[model samples]
Target: MVEPTGYDLLLKGGRVICPATGVDGIRDVGVRGGRIAAVADAILPTSAAQTVDVSGKLVLPGLIDTHGHIYQYVTGRFGLDPDMVGVRSGVTTVVDQGGPSCMTLPGFRHFIAERSETNVLCFLSAYLVGGLEGHFYPNLYSPDGVDIDATVRSAVANRDLVRGIKGHAEIGGFARWGIKVMEMAAEIARRAEIPLYVHFGQLWGLPESGANGEDADTILERVIPLLKEGDVLAHPFTRHPGGFVNAEGELHHVLQAAIDRGLTVDVGHGSHFSYRLAKMALAAGVVPHTLGADMHGYNTQVPEIPAPAGTPEEHADDENHPFKGQARFSLTQAMSSMMTLGLPLDYVVKMVTTHPAKMLGMEDSLGSLAVGRVADVSVLDDVRGRFVLRDNEDYRVIAERLLQPAFCLRAGKRFDADSPILPQAIAA
Candidate 1:
């Protein structure tokens, strides 16, 4: 009798949904040698060394987070552990948004990316300071602080890890330095030939002298022309100024035009999210292409890590400060938020999987469950119940269904989804 050539592991009888590959149905996934061996309607249980029944669960291409701040210890108290926000949270890949600059890329690569079980990537900071203390000091992010040539060189030199360029076009920056900083960021992204991811909410406090004749409502128009087709406009539903909505509470007309011009949108859903604003934007047909949890220390209830000596202390009285030390959130919760806002489950899945892969320009390797691809899969419990979801502003909505991560496979290795930061579903 001949021995059966079998897989190393198999996930059996799960509702597999791979949007990029156009597959949505019950399937069995076989993994061997750290790649997808097969995804068929049914593979005999005997065909694998080990098999786990996943009936009534969702099996998808591993989730990818487009915005994360995981430069732990180096960025004061603002960064979280990569694995805490990655595989342990049922996400396979995390793109650290603006955490590493040219000066810090080497440390980021060696200490953060290589040492972690989860796959880590970066959006090189356009500024030299590079997410220091979550970009807290307004003076450090000025136009004069950007070294375009150095940033471009760093991005090009580290193409394997750096996917895009991260910068801001918010009201505070506009009031401080006008559009010079954005122009420099655009130039760096252009030179590197990668997508530019721009934040569109208030990141810095305004100058004491006020708006300086620069209006928050007009910031998008000025920045849009500077951005190329593949550039990203993030924080569409931010409660802060300089987001997708204009001063009159209407969706900015220029937003549709930016989309028409091939620009992408990302829901940098953090403490910035507002359900009311999300509804308005969705009603105006401005769906985001990608969804990111934007998890960092300030907005999450992380184990307290004392800031390094001489590090700037967090001032508690800032009126615009996000709720600190009290909330638990994850990318799965962001997906639930979209569903609560009436986006179909399939579309929401795409926002975290396929769409994010495309945004990272990693289509061939990361987005699909096609055979021969890396065996990075996410298994989720598709719970059906009445759950109450809330946002930063304390607005609430009831959702009939919620998707929670169960576990994930990264390069065929299993990681249980058990991050302490994962939010519990409050019964409605």
Candidate 2:
């Protein structure tokens, strides 16, 4: 009898951790024609066209970044290239939250989503104008800016790419016109029959607020009623006002109620993340359901971060190559931060995989290692050493176990971790 052809690519003897299947073992994963063909104890090297020895690495489902911006040339200063944060960064899927509005959906489909190697999904911005310029124009985020009929229509038309609706329930907009904007956004989401991905916390610079003089402390009281089950509340760990931590430095009592109502708390880990605040929440036993690295050109590709302040180094020369740019990172760094905060490796892996996939409503097909599933996998180099991690608030934590992306397979195709956005190893 003739021998049957084997898998196209095989990952051998890696510590596979699939949150969906509760798999934490050394196994061989075989890929065939962009789908997972088999996962077992052993697959002979000759049984595949390319067999990679991943014995010491941590192999898991490809990461699902629940939040980021990558509309590229269209969003200009706010956007980064899709692939820069996607396949190259070991993230198989990335949800571009609020990057494209209803009007820009078609352009986004052709220009950004279809062209990239990484899979791009969108939480369509509720505004008809979309996330143009990152809402720099505060007036655009006002209630009047959201066109209910148009936004809903666009979402339905692009249902394949549109996973949910995007809205910004920030202090500036609430202050400007109260919850009128949020209500409109909520209505748009309702009509579209999708969840609303709401961006919370402060929207403006310090001490400035709504024209009606609504304070940040009242944000939850005002916005919570508008959120239904499946709604996403982002930026729980932000240092800014209007986030999970109240102005009095206490976790908001309403957080539990929102969770009970089935709302998802996504840690939109961005330039505003605060370790001090995050630790407080963890102490209160409130953990985010998902993690979204709010990476963008503004934070990652250098919108400018003044050099860190420290005591003078007497011996350093110009060749020392002083780190002058901002401390930007990908999903791997965010996962490391969660690990540093005491989340177990398996739990952290779930947050990036199962949790996010379920939240994005792609749970059935994504976020697993089941045979016949899309072969999207992430290979991580688990390094043990003193690694310094800093949050946006300048708070630091030294983590002994850090996960660095070595590469990723998007639909069974390989993409190396050569993106400039990957965080560099910080010497302890």
Candidate 3:
């Protein structure tokens, strides 16, 4: 009898790591019609149409960034293209964090999401007014903007693309208004049976006032009670007055209590989330349940720092300082940071891939390389070197470097890195 036809593409001789299964052995991955057909000790060269040898390199599941803001791309900033920043950097899925809301979802659905090569998901902002508005406060607090009924309608209408609800509850800036607004969002999420993604503030406090008012402890106290098991506490490591660290420079019990109660903690490493807090939390054994770039146009520039005096009005884009230029931390950079904190590579990989997928309730369909799963794959050149990984202007040592994607397969088709794709592919 004739042997069955082999796969369309085969990745050969790489150390395949499946964090879900705790498998980290050299293996070959076979792909057919954009699905992972097989992973084995070795697949003969002749069993596939094309083969790329990835000898001596580490192969893990394509990363899934749980937080980011890609809407800034439409406004002209330097954020890396989602596909390039993601697929090329070994990240296959990206959740656009609160970039779009009810009013702007259509634009995102058409202009950004449809045209991108990356697999993009969205966490709809609780505010109907969208993040790109001119006001410092998002319109969500406005009666017209905070219409939970409408938000729910929109979420249900676009259930396939809308993953959950997102809101930023910063203490001094918008916490007072945001608390009520997010409550509405939570109600809507509950009705829709979706998770709620909250960016809890550190500077703003409970009564919601003070220079370092909102501490992480207080924020967690109020927010944790409102959240269900699957709800996310994004940016759990920011070093603001109420962040992971207390005034005494110790890990706060409140933060630990929330985690213990099943609140999923995500390191949404944006412009403001503090590296100090991240280091402390890691040291305290608080591993981030997920990792995201929080990438926005301004935040995409590598080595992003404080803006010089009097540049332009456009710079005032996101009140959040870190999203102003290319973020200091890329998705891979975030993973590297976790590795430096003593997390094994497999565990770190899970935080970005499987964990986020499970958090979003898309695990069976998206995160793993199981047979019949979507053919989303990223290949990397594991460049060996020692380097520093920085976040929000703080630096840490990374003993190795992971080169960007050599090739990406999205939905069973190879994305041509050289194709006249707009927004040039970002270097890995």
C-alpha RMSD for every candidate: 2.3, 5.8, 4.9
Q: Encode model 3's per-residue lDDT on 259-330: one tens digit a residue.
A: 787878888876656666677778887877888866554545532333334434564434544344333446
What is the RMSD, in Å, between candidate 1 and the native fold over all Cα? 2.3
Candidate 3: residue 287 lDDT (0-100): 79
Better of 2 and 3 by lDDT: 2
lDDT of each: 0.89, 0.84, 0.67
Candidate 1 weakest ten by summed lDDT: 316-325
What are the TM-scores, per candidate, against the unseen true structure?
0.96, 0.92, 0.84
**Candidate 1 stretches greater than 4 Å from native:** 1-4, 307-322
Error of 3 at 107 (Å): 2.1
Residue range 1-428, candidate 2, lDDT tens digits:
97355989999989999989878999999999999999999998899999999989999998999998998766655688889889999899999999899889999999999999999999998876677653345666767788899999999989889999988877777767778888998998888989998887876433243246778888876788888899988898888788888989998898898899899888888777888999998999889888998888666755332222331243122222222244676799999999999888888999999998888788887789888899999999999999888876668889898888989999999999899877788967
Residue 67 lDDT in candidate 2: 90
Query: Stretches of candidate 3 above 4 Å error?
Result: 1-3, 72-80, 133-144, 173-178, 202-217, 302-327, 396-404, 416-428
